[model samples]
Target: MWGRTARRRCPRGLRRGREALLVLLALLALAGLGSVLRARHGAGARAADPGPPRTPRLGRREPVLPRPPVPANALGARGEAVRLQLQGEELRLQEESVRLHQINIYLSDRISLHRRLPERWNPLCKEKKYDYDNLPRTSVIIAFYNEAWSTLLRTVYSVLETSPDILLEEVILVDDYSDREHLKERLANELSGLPKVRLIRANKREGLVRARLLGASAARGDVLTFLDCHCECHEGWLEPLLQRIHEEESAVVCPVIDVIDWNTFEYLGNSGEPQIGGFDWRLVFTWHTVPERERIRMRSPVDVIRSPTMAGGLFAVSKKYFEYLGSYDTGMEVWGGENLEFSFRIWQCGGVLETHPCSHVGHVFPKQAPYSRNKALANSVRAAEVWMDEFKELYYHRNPHARLEPFGDVTERKQLRAKLQCKDFKWFLETVYPELHVPEDRPGFFGMLQNQGLKDYCFDYNPPDENQIVGHQVILYVCHGMGHNQFFEYTSQKEIRYNTHQPEGCIAVEAGMDILIMHLCEETAPENQKFILQEDGSLFHEQSKKCVQAARKESSDSFVPLLRDCTNSDHQKWFFKERML
Candidate 1:
């Protein structure tokens, strides 16, 4: 050992080299052992503590929630959750929104499937079937004529908001030759992004009535819902209308209208509960409601109350029924009296007209009258005259102060009415809707006709054939004809007599007559000559016409022959009901 040690120390360079090599080998061995230990430790940890079970990846497949069965009573509380679920998806957060929407649709058809989903997910899903599928699909038809952009956008958004996505098949926008600079292009461009929106532009101006007819022709849905260009929709509007249609197949339904301030574009609350009132000969719309007592007596909201007529704007009906009713009277010149014509025909032709409380829409009432089209106004007046001929006597009876223009021919409506086998207006009042408070004389009540009896005869006398006979009976009053303006009072109990030549002479008729007529005499007629009938049926005259002749005729003919002569007179032959006074 001493000799070996001496040899190793003999070379210092050799000893240093050997020591370095040994150190290198030891470090390599230690590194290898450390790596092996780390591998073993990682495997042991993974095996000893199992991680939570991994959920199956859904991948590209859409998640579906089962559809719920349609409830028998859709309006009940049981269905409320489902409806909220469907509507709520519209506001979901971006990441989860697509999945939730798909789930909502699937659940709408299968509620049971939704019930099976995890309890945590129940609040996010809607599983009720709103049974609109049994009802006809509705096509919302809107006419745009230089409509304001904001108004149009609001209308579109409102419809989308209130209307159920499944029930709405299409929205038809008819452009009646609007001249607004950017309206056509902007409308088209914006609507391009929406599905089931159709834009139709007419090169020439087709009046409102005709334009609507054209839109209806193009519509594909089973039901037609007509909306004005300027309107905002309220919640639950579509459901009520759809329900009504389902209950009464032949019924025409209108939503309650709330007025909007045109200047501010703000909603002015509803005028009142919607009531249906007829027009006087002047074509003024009257507001009346179901008596409070009568409304309170009803047990359910489904009561079929009588409405004298419907407001032309925001009305709905089955497309088939609309077409069968002659579709807005092609003969009607334009927009004016078309609504009245539609109302009368629907009521008189075995169809029911109603206003639903659950539905509401807003319209802009003009602060000032539009003055651009004198011809259009005249045309509207002409249309009302042509279509509301039978009700003319009743109209004038209620509106004595109205100055009516002569009516032209209406052969088209007559032909259509005959083809549909429409029942007479009298039959409609007496049978199908006995609850309606229609007076015996519509014109007389409205102060339009000169005599209640004049509606029966075709006119045959005099120059200006249209004006030969006074339409309404003259009423004599104790005061100067100026006591009340000459037109008949709508709700007064006393008989009126013409005491002065003032244009304010009131028209008088029998208390129970179905129709009333008024004679609008020249403004300069003598006051003393005005005549009135007393409670005893005796004539009291200031002597405008021969009092002796009037008295003799009052007793012998009961004023029937004079009325017949006027009715037959060529002047009164062509009358229609104008909606605008």
Candidate 2:
């Protein structure tokens, strides 16, 4: 037994060698695991911070979140213009397109619902990053009335395709009681399969303001994103907006609105200096070049551009903050002055209104507005009465008809202003929009320019249409006493400005013709636009060396203003509304 035990115990060296082999295997496993962990850490770091900025590839596909596949060869893909050879039935389709949505709806139908848009973002925006995980989720609210099937659905699909699923809480489509066939059950069925999409219908026509309010009421997200029914969102548009709102809850941000040609459906991105919102004394929204102050404040091209007012169709705001600011004026009938009202409220009520250059949205700007109802005048009146304070006189001075408009009771809005302890409109003009040209500043000879000869006749400068504002013929019509079309201001600069709106036109001699026309006012007060209202009431044109005379046109019974040799005739003599008073 002792000999057998000694033989078994003699294998101690071999057992030690086996134990050493096990230790070596254990060390190798640990090394492999450490390499894997290090690789994962590197991948995560790459995702979070894409190393020091390289030259941004303008349209580079940076799919941090899974995105919809781009149909590279599809029609209207890459935001290219789609034109159809007008022949046979195609012409009728084009006509139908015009009649329907005032856009090329026929071509819109042919485009893929998930069509890819060209990356029209600035290089700085492309290089910008946002914390996606922590950003607030938004409920996209799109309000529509008689919207086309393709355009509305394309808007929906574009958002879904571009927005990260986790960040998009839901999409609420508020149909403003559209009577169209497709908008009823077809819209619902089409949206049924789409996750996080809801369609709510108004029992009666609620108009845009109320329709959006309905959508906001039903939203269950941290932020409310309002988009027009005919918009194509670019990739990464949502993140920057959410990030801005996340950083400052009171910030209401808008995307850089690119133009989608209504006729050709081509996407036009403005990579140049961005335009900010401004308004004239008439309370109409106008786009102005970014002021030097605002430009200086923007450290990068991707920074937010402060605006006096928003274009209004597309913007994002924190849900809680929006509600606190009263969302929108419920009394506003339709879509006219809502943007300005919201803009004024935002600035006066301790909120930030900004345009994020990092986010881009392409909107179809129709050549002419399809809707006939222009409650804008009434809506503007309400806003002026409620918020404009003493500055409301500036709006009223240019728009005397607004005084008669039965703008619904603004008591509630006034109460809201008082409740919010909002700053007066004076602060808004002086602090926020000092670049705006205030006619009252250089109040010289303003109001209806009445002809001393033709009793009750005044210089009426009505554009044949909204598009014909520049270089339109000025005519003499019966003075309406209303300040709109007849509103003329003989500026201290010796220019007779047709002061209806911004970029105010000056009474100038038509090239090679003695006819009086409205030309864009030049800064130099050139000889053509220069007019001297003599003490005798004669409007002497400096360049033409003639006086403006009311001449009866040979073709029609109507009279037109013409430049002729200076005379003592009563027709050449004019009196301003201020003088008449």
Instruction: Write down the RMSD of candidate 2 (Cα, Å).
Output: 16.2
Q: What TM-scores do the predictions have?
A: 0.54, 0.82
- Cα lDDT of candidate 1 equals 0.51
How high is the lDDT of residue 221 in model 1?
84
Tens-place lDDT per residue, model 2, 1-581, is 11111122222344477689999999977877655666667755323323486653222133323446667877878889888788879889878878867888888888877777777778777777766667788899999999889899889888887887768888999999888898888889999988789999999988899999999999999999999999999888899999988877778899999999998888887766678888877887888888899889888877899999999889999888788788899888977999999999988887778998888999998756768658888989988998988878767768877877999898889888888778888888898988766665245488888888888888888887654578788889988877878888888888888767887788888668988888888777887888899999999988878888988988898888888889899999997874234
Shift in Å, residue 92, candidate 2: 1.8
lDDT of each: 0.51, 0.82
Candidate topping lDDT: 2
lDDT of 1 by residue, 80-132 (tens): 23433334544343214224321222223232211211111111112312455
True lDDT of residue 405, candidate 1: 44
